[model samples]
Target: MEENAISGDDNTHWFHSNGIITSIDNSQKKICVDISQKNSFFDGTNITLNCNKSSLDITYLEAGQEITFYFFENNVLDTEVAIEKLNIVTP
Candidate 1:
């Protein structure tokens, strides 16, 4: 059984990282998550999660909160790299 993967436009990616909230851009509804710790995923970097793209209800997220989530690039005509969806796993 495969898990922790998000697919859009026939493209698939993994974002099964347990990260801590680093910052929140309420203006743009973007949340910066630091995946440097918790489960070993990626190169331990930070990724920005856009609320507009997320299906999960994270309107009450705060800095220092821990969560596991999946994220994927929007892949919009190569104009820019942005998040398509960021789903936070509910504990």
Candidate 2:
């Protein structure tokens, strides 16, 4: 899949978020994502997603799993500020 960058909002300090995978560091409880917009800079590149103290839980999440996340501007605390929800589908 293609990757891209997401611009954050200036007002609420939030930006656009998308679905990605928790590529590496599964043991450390971290989710890596490619927030870059499709066909934008850093496309097809891997971006480290941070998961801070939020209600969203990604413990059961595994590599290659798809997830929707929320983006915020001037917010670098957690790569994944807010996780939309989990999609469980049979493969």
Candidate 3:
């Protein structure tokens, strides 16, 4: 099963969000994503999503890089959530 598939325990579900890399904190291993699209997870415009710890190689990530990230529902706080799966979206 895909990690991003809609499956989870009774507590929460998973969702994917698309956005651009606004900033990166290599020391913290965190990537600040500027959400460009809206879904059930993000409803506001221009929200920055702090994503971290993905199976993908995030070492090569940089600002302006488009990406799709999977995260759990209700795990977001002010638009920030830990990334379960991160995939670079090539143009």
> Clash number for every model?
0, 9, 0
* TM-score of structure candidate 3: 0.71
TM-score ranking of the models: 3, 1, 2
Best by lDDT: 3
Tens-digit lDDT track for model 1 on 1-91? 1235554443566444466778887778777777645343343357666566545456777888876655453332121224544444433
What is candidate 2's TM-score against the reference? 0.52
lDDT per residue, candidate 2, 1-91, as tens digits?
A: 3422344335353343444574756455467875434433233446556554355466767766655454443444433333333342311
Worst 10 contiguous positions by lDDT, candidate 2: 82-91
The sequence of per-residue lDDT tens digits that candidate 3 reaches over residues 1-91 is 1234467674566677778887887766777777765565655645545444555466788799888887776666765676677788964
For each candidate, C-alpha RMSD in Å? 5.5, 5.6, 4.0
Best by TM-score: 3
Candidate closer to the true structure by lDDT (higher is better), 1 or 2: 1
Error of 3 at 21 (Å): 0.5
What lDDT does each candidate get? 0.55, 0.48, 0.68
Candidate 3 clashing pairs?
A: none
